[model samples]
Target: MTAPAEPPRFVVMGPSGAGKSVVGAALAERLAERFPGLRFVDADDLHPASNVEKMRAGIALDDHDRMPWLALVGGELAAGADGRVVACSALKRSYRDAIRAACPDAVFVELVVPAGELGDRVVRRPGHFMPASLVASQLGALEPLDGDERGIRIENTGPVDGVVTRVIAALDAGW
Candidate 1:
């Protein structure tokens, strides 16, 4: 008899205001219907207190401050036996590399939003540690997925449901 297909591991990645959390959560919920035990993890919750404090204080994090946290996120993704979806501001190629180091099979879904709109969304968001001021820094640091990466990018305008539908389609297409 044939073995069942392995479950997918996904990182919903982008800059700070690119709707990673919302999109990742929704995607996990939808996928869980088909892949039982799939879990959604918001990488923001994985941040060390110092990192959170740095963001809360409007200070952009440097590589020294971020590497450990990225390692933790990677470990979490790698530890998922069934399937996992994580929302993370994996802005730099090096950061994504860090995650891939731990979970080489991980796929990515990057949500793209205009800089102006991203700024607006972050400013209006409440209680989030990352301030709107950091949006520019994130955009400046962002590296879109390389051609060889296993992933897809979708414009994240209009309703969220539409964006989710696009993600599902891309996954169906074997992205």
Candidate 2:
């Protein structure tokens, strides 16, 4: 993990079924527990209406639809909330780039889960606009972390507590 010059923004990113939300939430809680002043933002809350509609109807979003969403999420990153963890399905490198453009200091934590497990997760989750079928497209768009970046790329194959603990350790190590 590369230590940031500052308490850089972080996006807990991956495909739809990669436990981004679950792990992001856990990480946020952990951060809050350790540093009461820390703030955590849920990036999904910034998605545009049309993009939500598209995903709700099982239609995959193109880069065009995602650009504005990226910008919005990035805007939040620019706020520079210390120990913040934003949950976003940052499926492409360009999408990651867009968010980074807004807050160049931020680092990414690539949450990873096997395809088969992801399918199971999508099936089990409820009330979310994202459809299980859309997982394939999201996976298709993913750019692997290449194990080269200075952040956690967790297996996301464990329980939420364990996952969160790993992230906390990674962050402590300044990933």
Candidate 3:
């Protein structure tokens, strides 16, 4: 008998207000249909209380503040038995590297959106600790996936289903 294909690991990444959580959840659901053990994890839930408070106060977290949290997030991804779809800002290259260190086969999917739209979306999102004001900080910190990165960049200006479709297609194409 043939061996079962390995479960896919994905990181749905983007700046604040780029719909990482929403898209990641949807992607996880779709993936679960094809890969029974796939699940979704929100990186925000892994943040230290202090980090949450800092972002809630509209303060941008420095690398020092993020390293520990990133480590925890990476550990979760690495520990997943089947497959995991995680949503995280992962704004800098080093941060992505941290995640890659944990799950080397993890594929990244970057959601690209215009700044104005991102700002609007952030302000409209309810009960989220990340303030709209911090959107600019996230944008400033964002480092687009490099040439060597195993990932695909999708524009999120369209409907959620469309974006999800594109992501799945890209993944199937070995992006």
Candidate 4:
């Protein structure tokens, strides 16, 4: 019989409103049966209050504002190296590099959706500090997963369960 695949260290990454939280949660639930210690961390929880306030005020955060938050998220991922599913914006290549520095084997799952969809999703999301007005800025900062990156880009135009299934299949295939 084939050996079971190793539990994945997944970072559900994308610009705002790409369904990172929903998909990551679903992925974690699906993987929990096999990976007992798996946990999900919402990177937004690591953001400083000031950053949250800024975003709530419709101000886009700069790289400097994000470094500390990224470091914290990286630390969590590294600490949970055995099995973790984290939802994070991870917009810039440099930010992703920071995450990789902490957990070298991390597999990023980048969620891609059209701008209009992204905007609508962001606007409809309740209680999120990130305002729809900043969607463009987040998109502008986004750096797609590169050839050398250990990652996959999934279009999130459909149901959350469908996206989660694709992620699981990709992980099983060692993508």
TM-scores, one per candidate: 0.96, 0.89, 0.95, 0.94
Rank order (by TM-score, best first): 1, 3, 4, 2
User: In candidate 3, what residue range of length 10 has the lowest lDDT sum?
Assistant: 1-10
Residue 109 lDDT in candidate 3:
95
**lDDT, each prediction:** 0.89, 0.79, 0.89, 0.87
- Prediction-by-prediction clash tally: 0, 0, 0, 0
Candidate 1 has its poorest 10 consecutive residues by lDDT at 1-10
TM-score of 3: 0.95
**Root-mean-square deviation of Cα positions for candidate 3 versus the true structure, in angstroms:** 2.3
lDDT: worst 10-residue window of model 4: 1-10
Candidate 4: lDDT of 133?
A: 92
Q: Where is model 1 more than 4 Å wrong at Cα? A: 1-4
Candidate 4: tens digits of C-alpha lDDT, residues 12-127: 99999999999999888878877777899899999999999999999999988988888888888878535789999998899999988888778899999998899999989998
- Candidate 4 clashes between residue pairs 3 or more apart in a chain or in different chains: none
lDDT of 3 at 67: 90
Cα lDDT of candidate 3 equals 0.89
Model 3, span 43-83: residue lDDT tens: 99999999999999989999999998888888887776788
What lDDT does model 1 reach?
Answer: 0.89
* Position 82, candidate 4: lDDT: 54
